[model samples]
Target: MVERLRYPGGLRLLLTPNRSLSWRGNVRIWLLLALVSGIIAGGWALAGVWFILPFAGLELMGVAAGIYVTSRNCQRKEVVTIEGDTIHIESGLNRKEHDWILPVRNTRLESFPPNTPFDCHRVRLANRQQQIPLGDFLNNADTDALVHALKARGINILQTEQQPTVGIWF
Candidate 1:
């Protein structure tokens, strides 16, 4: 999801991934699975199959961890603020954040075409020193929206046929 807010200085783009399930829904799913598995496993354990109990506990723990990670990822966000002659970007998952500042004139955006297998469109923000990926967590439609929003804000976007890969020098 791309939210465009026009601040006093310039534009602010708030980017988030599209979530099909709500927090409550995710929790409900985990709870349902855990309850069902626990009942079946406990019944089997009572019938002399003691090994099923430990396996069921492990399965429950794994499911809980997976749901937790997914929830944390859903909380992730990237904020891009274009003010005056510079653009500021703050992005991270959870509490750890990274900041980047680039002069408006030096900054540019590139749109890479989707691959034959994945069908994921990539948008990247770059300057002389670094290139930061934008909307990498979003879907194709959301990425399209992000590109359009940046373009509407006077940022030039370049289309690319292939994704650029960097190779380390020996």
Candidate 2:
């Protein structure tokens, strides 16, 4: 999910990963799968293949573990707010939150292409002293839209002639 709000003097951007399965939906699917597996395993157990029941239980446990891990990060979000001469960024994943504050006049926005074709591109805000990445879960289109929105707000984006070139080494 990508949402952008433009105000008279600033902009707010929200980015979240798209989740195909909700927690409730996951539980329903898991229960259905367990029931089917149990019925099959019970039939085999009745036929004297008792080991099949334990193996099915093990498989169900593995599936449950995967679902639990995935649900932990499903609520992750990246929030960006640009007001006056300041930019604020807040991000959270798995209940851990991080924040960054940058002066609009001194900060520069930099975008890096994904390392591989399958990876999502990254955007960062940096100054002479520090740099912080944003939008780790955003897809290419959302990242691009974010950059465009920032530029529209008169924010200095790296590589633009309006801002001095800063070495990428930082």
Candidate 3:
């Protein structure tokens, strides 16, 4: 479920819903622990154990708050368009924009494993000295095609000598 959220000034962001982080997104182990805690609470409630009900309620509240914060923080509204002088990236509720050089001569796009160092999509993009995850914006096929198009247009994608072992979360 890919939905498009657009803003003024030609800024477009894509929202991919129903995508859960496989074992990788559970960095804090909240989801895993939530399941266990929910079961315990449910069992206790069923057995007329009233005291543990409060603990269960607290845990449930914590999980809900965590999810809300995560969703809000992950709301990175990426804006990619060709302006007269630069390319821009805007994100968050404030919609701040950053301008990169017209031609990012040192930009490189590579496919990296998902949920290795950071929990994100499988593609990694390197521009100048900065690295950003490309998964949030482009799908697998689209990313590959974009890389090829950029390379054909004289954008250099420096390949790394050391290959990284990709992690796949079940």
- The regions of model 1 sitting more than 4 angstroms off are 163-170
Per-candidate TM-score against the hidden true structure: 0.87, 0.84, 0.49
Local accuracy of candidate 1 as per-residue lDDT tens digits, 1-170: 88987688888988988888988999999899988998999899999998998889998999889888888788889999988888899998875389999887878898988754455889899887999999788888889988887887778788987655444531
lDDT of 2 at 157: 79
Candidate 2, residues 1-170, lDDT tens digits: the string is 67986667678988888789999999999999999999999999999999898799999999999998888777898888999889988888754388888888998888777654556767888999988877777788988888898888787877422223345532
lDDT of 3 by residue, 91-164 (tens): 34446544333334455556553434443345545666666554354455555554554455455565444345
Model 2 TM-score, all chains together: 0.84
Worst 10 residues of 3 by lDDT: 10-19
Descending-TM-score candidate ranking: 1, 2, 3
* Model with the higher lDDT, candidate 1 or 2: 1
Give the range where candidate 2 is weakest over 10 consecutive residues by summed lDDT: 161-170
> Alpha carbon lDDT of residue 84, candidate 1?
81
